[model samples]
Target: MMNACPEKVIRMMDDYLDGEISPSEEKELKDYLQSCSDCRKIYQELTKTIAFVQSVSHVQAPPDFVQKTMAGLPKESQRVGVKRFMRHHPLMIAAALFVLLMSAAMMSSFSDDQQFSFTKQENLVVEGQTVVVPEGQTVIGDLTIRNGDLRVDGELEGDVTIVNGQYMASSGVINGEIEEIDQVFEWLWYTIKGTFQDAMSFFGGDDQSIEE
Candidate 1:
């Protein structure tokens, strides 16, 4: 029978007995407990119940508990063993395949040269450009040299055409006709051919002789 109802103080007392009150609230409970008998009684009962539960809830394991559990299994079973289970779960399998493909590509990049061969094809040489035909080369389609210099020592199964450029064919055979823009190319061709021919004729005749 406290003089004041002390509802807020009583609330703090309940929270404190349950260990739910903060330090400030505990101070309030202390001040109230000094003057309140009914709240003190409730707090003492809650503290006793909490202590009893904590004292009885924790227990030590019996000595024979583990042995009793182990003894429940069969002793003479033959195939209770385990093997490695490699679960090729979808994501891991895809990652493994991708790594393998990248490794193969990296290895192939360091390998020998990759040559591209196009058979039964044409050779088109551009103007002011130098064309080189490798040895044992053969073209079945028509060859066009447009204002360019071509060195054709390879075999061509079809015609060879030029437009205003030089054609230096050395021992290669053309099975079809050879066409050109002869009006413009003829002057360049004659200039070069005449210079070379004059040099050769001068050496062969008495006009010029090779000196030691």
Candidate 2:
């Protein structure tokens, strides 16, 4: 019967078969293998297994495999269209945003520069220039002015609405609120609302006058 070999000799059997061990270690393992039948059997099994794996046929994929796989995907034009759309979508959105911003800025600038004035009178004077409420003057009812500076030196019994102009009030009395419309959007909204109200008032006043 063959004697049991050391664990180190069994571990070195594969390394020795592969010529991976140092010369001294290979010599030691070879000497032990010659004396140990069990270790020799293990080494023969590992050597046979490695030879079998190396001798096996290596199968390759078909030459058209890659072409067939790619053919199953989207066509070049379809992919190009998608990529082109994706590339230009941001530019289109940016251009639209730029146009909107420019439009808003233009409207704001136009509104700021646009000129308007109220009817002139002794108590309420309006000119192409600044509107000045002379000192000690008293004006009744709501006052609306546009596109001109307002210098209030007297007393007003109603609200003051100024558009696209500065309101300078020093030692003046306003019995109602002071509203300034400086932006295009704000001025547009106020003008539309005031026009509607005036139309409604005119119709209502006509009905009242007819009834009277």
Per-candidate clash tally: 1, 0
| Model 1: how far residue 75 lies from native, Å | 10
Q: What is the TM-score of each candidate against the true structure?
A: 0.29, 0.37
**Candidate 1 stretches greater than 4 Å from native:** 1-10, 72-212
Error of 2 at 161 (Å): 0.9
lDDT, model 2, position 191: 51
Q: What's the lDDT of the predicted structure labeled candidate 2?
A: 0.72
Kindly list the per-residue Cα lDDT of model 1 for residues 1-212, writing each as its tens digit.
Answer: 64354789768866876779999989878887878887677668778988898889667789998999889977744332311111324345435545555455435432411321122255533223655454577767776655465666677777766655556866766678876644634534544554555544543563232121
Q: Per-residue lDDT of 1-212 in model 2, one digit per residue for the tens?
A: 23376778866875776678999998888888788888888788888999999999999999999999998996677766655664557456445545565566556646655657753545975545677777799888777777877777887788778877878857878899988988878966665565555555655565453333
Give the 10-residue window scoring lowest on summed lDDT in candidate 2: 203-212
Task: Tell me the deviation in Å of residue 24 in model 2.
Answer: 99
**Which residue pairs collide in model 2, if any?**
none
